[model samples]
Target chain A: MKQLGLSVREDAVGNIFGRWVGSEAELGAVATGSHVDAIPFSGKYDGVVGVLGALEAISVLQRSGFQPKRSLEVIMFTSEEPTRFGISCLGSRLMAGSEELVRSLKRTVDNHNVSFVDAADSAGYKIHPDDLHNVFLNQDAYFAFIELHIEQGPILEKEGIPIGIVTAIAAPASIKVEFEGNGGHAGAVLMPARNDAGLAAAELALAVEKYVLESGSIDTVGTVGILQLHPGAINSIPSKSHLEIDVRDIDEKRRNYVIEKVHKSAIDISKIRGVELSEFKIINQDPPALSDKSVINAMEFAAKQLGLEYKLMISRAYHDSLFMAREYHQWV
Target chain B: MKQLGLSVREDAVGNIFGRWVGSEAELGAVATGSHVDAIPFSGKYDGVVGVLGALEAISVLQRSGFQPKRSLEVIMFTSEEPTRFGISCLGSRLMAGSEELVRSLKRTVDNHNVSFVDAADSAGYKIHPDDLHNVFLNQDAYFAFIELHIEQGPILEKEGIPIGIVTAIAAPASIKVEFEGNGGHAGAVLMPARNDAGLAAAELALAVEKYVLESGSIDTVGTVGILQLHPGAINSIPSKSHLEIDVRDIDEKRRNYVIEKVHKSAIDISKIRGVELSEFKIINQDPPALSDKSVINAMEFAAKQLGLEYKLMISRAYHDSLFMAREYHQWV
Candidate 1:
């Protein structure tokens, strides 16, 4: 509550930080929780739900006269959409002790002109890489970290569950495959003589689909979401094809199996179609984070007291918690 | 021959006509012909061989001081490559009374800035709908038309044949098919939920190849020379695919069968892929032409007199003679 001598700080990039001073014994200590700034129109609950839910929980604790072991802080990060700077979870990723991703984000969408430094500066935010440490200092003082989110998929709703207790967030790997073939006049050429890179790519794509379907890895799956053919003329043979493969699983081993099959299928298709195929692993092996059992027990105990029906479920989507959990392994 | 006082006249497009003066007793004239342009980097023998061969035959007759019952004329038409003007045998087609084909040729390659009038002017030719008859004049003057052309295929050389008398030339039907689908983020979407236009196109192309091979028409064949995926991106689904189908046969019915199968297959693929697909028949049908047996006999007689061996063979490629033969159907 503002009556507790609360104050707020606003950064140049519109990053807002609000604090509620704890008792004198807990002063100079910190506990942090917050959400991102924006979401698309369709994603009404994404970041907004997390920030509002945390604030509501804090208010309830205040109303009940409950006190924490350490100073409790609620924070909202900025530019989490990555829509503006091409860097999703920019605020959290930076707070988790890595600025390396910022370098790569600078070259996003094939544009190298806008560096991460420029993006920050353009948004009127200071580019002090050293100051990033301040964001993590509170992590050590926090007694616990928690995030409340809407179940984006149908699993919880289908089961008629009102709330979900998070267990593990599934990891994903994104792969890009490109095939190169000779471009030539289509009419005068014979099929037997063609390298036909597009055909090769198609065969591989279909094989990937069939492989995933037949593999029956209950915990893993693969999908082809992007396909491109180059020098696409109605009368000229296609010279190149690019395809994207997205495979994910809570079980890393099964995900690896799907990826290996995809690569093998691509190689076989290239050989059969007489074209050269190459594979590029863009996002490799982000392992799933298993939630802390102690936190789950505490949440279940609280749910019982509140008479709220909840179920344990796996997080199929990635979130900022995955990175924060990396810093506090037991919290995950 | 040059010594025989031959007079020449040319149209605006440089289609040359040569007439040799003869005695009044010879009421009709015999025409020997061919075009003189080559395909890009083609062998010199392709077009020039036909013209030079006919000229050599006439030269030998002139040296022998032989006189025929009819006056003989040699002619050379222009723009046979379809490279500069995008239409093959334009001069001959015009001369053979195909005004519709001329109009269709003008419509080729849509969105092209060059108008038909501008294209004619740029090519040093003028097309006036009223003056179309001028190009097709003097139709009854020809007693017979004999054309000499090199075999485009290697069948004659492989069989060690010395010469071949023309029988019929094969006709080809070229068709263009395009499939449109929704393009969206690939990773965030599922296959069953996608319309995947490019995938539908790929299936149709492969089906065409399979159907043509299975049609059991020994001489009937089909090819997909061009396959294009539009707005091709590595992580975005394809929204459109354009395909070119070239089906050919000595028999018109068989070619039509292949074309029909292609259309049916495309429709079926569109339905299966959950995308909208449509086709544009860019090039329709042109029936094969049968050369005149009387003219073949005359050529054979001349070859026999020169102690040369010859065999009758069908032409698998198109030539100006095809249209010319149609024009002089009675004599051809």
Candidate 2:
């Protein structure tokens, strides 16, 4: 921040902001940045690449001795990974007036009974209690915002595309389903009398695969990553089984439809086999985020101008851009 | 034993022999006995019943002032269940001059490095080392051998029949199979490109059920008692799985044929799915041991004379009689 002659500002929620005030400082700032925080064991490329890329872009712009019409800012948001406090983009959400929701949803970090308020109070921002509500950013002052992030999927690498202008981003909505049956000695129980939970789980897994494949395999993907059977001994007929399922697609309605179908089939199979089934939604996040058309066009135009290969792709994994695009921007 | 006018003698291999000398003591002793040892947690009826039944029969004869044409003897064989010492009919096999096989098969009992010979020597049997060979019972010296054992199956109970005269004994021929496959992150891997070991294992389990059911279900039975998977995690595809398989039938040829079919199908599936498969014969034990026809006829005749409902059925399990008939009296 000092090297670029930028002024530093901290939000009440601890979001760091660096402002390089142009002659038209009164005008909206053209923001270019990404979240600095990362998930555990994945700090190398996930958000770091985007962070460095944004800083380098800023440096390049500065060294060119060209001043932008609008002021420029590089902001690093806090807690982009939900692993720490359950919900991601805590700083952005707090500024966007979702502070109460974040507070209500959060219990404690590290199970230490440290409330979000308590954490923010001691986050070293040193903001007065009255200033906590002043964390909201002046969105009207920004003409455009862009986040450079890593592609978490194999799409770009497989296609040999150097740059990707994402049009949509996919987010997960998950469910946990369990089937209960009566277990018995495998040999002692006759085939007809057996209420095998493993069989029920296997059939459910296959059904999930079938439904997902049938519902436009390219658009939606459903997976039973965890299929746990109770009393998993071979000699003992399985008594209970459960699965942790994840389904994702760019279209929220399509994903919901597939989820409905999966739930229906599981229910039908459980009823047919006399196994008790129960399902609960663990996560019901927002629909997929579509990128700003003007911003996407700008990226495409720039790539074309540079004679670079690029793919107009959909992000199959979540990024900090998802939260950034919660509201419309003139040039994002 | 002294009160009952029975002479107690100990074999070199620790077999307890109680003899009631008759006028024809010069002739071979009419042996009537069973093993006193049983598998863990089972002592109510197994060998105890047979041992008591033989002694009761002898007591009844003594009470009736009966003079046997041949000398009568009741012997309690050792370590018949095979769970301990890892050998069935240890005493009987030793008496049959299978001392070398017994010694070779013997291991530390009770997790202690105690040898079988050491156990026998310490078992209160005061015998000269030179007389160890004398422990081999002369089959020609006995005209008959009878062992009355409790039916260890539900055949008699299910049929409501009081008596079950076992005509054959069934033992399992078991094998262990392992399937190896490539494991990867569940979410990152596409369905078509992924080599899921859990899926392979699940399909193999279903194949086992299918193959066993296809074979003559009434005669043959196959079971997978243990299914172990490596790095069992929800987010990771299973990399390896193993199963402990037990396949058994009365006819050795039929059992072997079924085993061969199972092995072939597993191999074929492994090849088709690109999963590495390996199977080894952990136990290639012999098939059912048919009882001596003369003894079966005598049992049937006695049940017939008593006007009782009896089933002269083949034993779908093993007993001391299987080893006793190794090389014994003309009637067993």
> Alpha-carbon interface RMSD of model 2?
5.2
lDDT of each: 0.66, 0.67
Candidate 2 has an fnat equal to 0.12
lDDT of 1 at A169: 76
lDDT of 2 by residue, B143-185 (tens): 6677777765556787899988877666556566778777643
The residue-level lDDT of candidate 1 at B213 comes to 70
Stretches of candidate 2 off by over 4 Å are: A1-152, A278-282, A301-307, A327-332, B1-191, B216-332
lDDT by residue (tens digit), candidate 1, B1-332:
35545677786456687776566435667777788987543457766876776677677877899776667777787766554434567677777778686566556443366765567767666766455556664567666677777776555677887888877777766677889887544333444556777777768777777777777765665656456666554334567777766676778888788788888888888888888876656465678788777777776898899998787876766677777776685333
Model 1, B88: alpha-carbon shift in Å?
A: 4.9
Which candidate wins on TM-score?
A: 1
